[model samples]
Target: MSTGQATLPLLNTTLENCRMVIIGVDPHKDVLVAVAVDGNGRQLALRDAPARPRGYKTLLAWTAQFEQRLWAVEDVRHVAGGFVRCLLAAGESVVWVPTQMSSDYRKKVRASGKSDPIDALACARAALAEDLPAAVPDTEARNVKMLLDHREDLVGEMVRMCSRLRWHLHDIDPDFAATIPKHKLHRPKWNKSVQEFLARQAGSVAVAICVELIGRIQELAQRAAQLEREIAALVVIHVPQLLALEGCGPLSAARILAETGDVRRFTSAAAYAMHTGTAPIPASSGNTHRVRLNRGGNRRLNAAIHRIAITQKRMHEPARTYLDNRRAKGNSNTEAIRALKRHLARRVYALLKNGPDHAQADTTVQAA
Candidate 1:
């Protein structure tokens, strides 16, 4: 779903007469409903398959036999790992049509309730008509996906446990915030210390509130530690370069890698910046021309870029100069950092696209 704002002209003109195929998949908890359509938007097949082994096998069989120039499937963001992996293994040209995009088409086409077959047909028609979106390729796709999802899960669990801990804390120590950090400690290393502190405090509270808080924090810490280990392992494999960058530790690098699946998909540095929301948006209608900050694109990527920029501002001559210039122009710290984020994204994109030589050239030219 991450894409640059620089919209390239559609390249499917050469595919006008080519046979395109679409396998519309509506994945559920236990079942996946799939329907196939031909190039001319003809319904070819419809079936309900098991969400696991049998369904995946069925989809793969169809993919192998079909002559498809484009195999459009619904969003692989939240689901469709097995399906996408199957398509990729078979070397099929897969396009990921966003769920919202497909839903909008259904609303416009049918304007009524939908069945699996009908929805699949709609998806196929969209693909044949070149209304489908390009599939986003991930750089360290598999590992990044696991790390990002697991990290988020751990964070959510920590949040839940912290809420309970706060309730318990409120009952025991009214002035707890004045003594301790406002946020609950999440690291596993701090788990025993926090538990012991809670245990000691609860002995004095007479309500046993600290006992529950200690247990919850310990559980949360263990989960967070597991997530950290998984993310570190993933970074060692997929995003080693990202980790090498200043301020882009394992966790941050993993987040960036997950957000930007494949930097090669972007045509240029500007395009990559635009997709990350670090590229500014030009507000020129007729004559009034100015580039305002863009608000769209992947927010997580934008955050990562900003963090990199902030890190670079220290000990880097050019980055420091840029930040000073922005500040002298009356821009706040946030605004200056955002501008730096844009520049940093472009640099990162160039590094990914043309390697160190071209990136150095770009930096030299910018400096001049």
Candidate 2:
């Protein structure tokens, strides 16, 4: 490939004097392609290595020629996580380049086609032109995220199995199916009853299938419960203050902690709110001021916050009063809930930043 000039302008004299080199990596399952560029965004070197420890060592040694270096890696966690951990463990400075930003950069610089080298160069240039978040080690948040995801998967599987089991039960004995509640199929009491009933029924393909599904559903429920306990313990250790807030349960708190991933990465509470999709977007016209709902940012985090807001609206006195005030001011129910979510974002950010001890004094939602 030609060593073409980058579309971005050259760095200022200060950065140029520092001679910092940005090494962008495009990681794949087996191999990684890397491109090294200087302050001027001119590609200086290119290399490919295995996506393993030996390959990481090779890249480290190869890049050592440049005294000042920063690794700009694509933000694909599954592919780049191990490489990033390796780099951080070696005391290397690194930052994540969002895939969209790099892809856009690639379009602007390259006329046609795409390759790993092109993508890697785009990552280097994108990092050079933008202020991206510095990469940090996968800490407690990673563990919470993994556990929460596994539990959700198990729950989803159980739901599907329960649905199938319901159909089978109705086929075998509609009267008995009506006796058992539609939603109680996964409960131990109901499952035991189901086992006893199935034992009495004459053996058939449908009966056999129902027996198998019930056993699987029971196992999945047990495993999901175990994961929830583990997650709750982690939440207790990391952000107990979050749980102290009304309507913020262990599962909700876990989602917030997992998605936020170090609230310090955000400059302030407003930034955190923006990331949660709770911050209102400006949609004003001339001589008119108005804000609209934001539909961007991490939707899963937004959903968690929305769940808390809904719970608070239903039960918490201060939250109810706050919603009443918003409604009195001509805000609709949806608008009131959005405002509440924004407020919750600020409180959540504070709790995560200050931990339990410092956050003990202000756990309740103040009427604002």
Candidate maximizing TM-score: 2
Writing each residue's lDDT as its tens digit, candidate 2 over 1-368 gives 24783122222223555489999999988999999999888999999999998999999999999998889998787888999999989988787776777888899765478999999999998878765556777779999998998899999999999999999999999999999898889999999999999999999999999999999999999999999999999999988888888899999999999888866666668867866789998878997656788875567899999999999999999999999998887778988899999999988888887777864646576665
lDDT of 1 by residue, 205-289 (tens): 5336555655666776677677788778877765465554555667777777777666655556775775678877666688554
Q: How accurate is candidate 2 locally (lDDT)?
A: 0.86
Candidate 2 regions exceeding 4 Å error are: 1-22, 35-47, 65-67, 97-131, 174-183, 292-295, 327-332, 366-368
- Count of clashes in candidate 1: 2
TM per candidate comes to 0.68, 0.80
Candidate 2 clashes between residue pairs 3 or more apart in a chain or in different chains: none
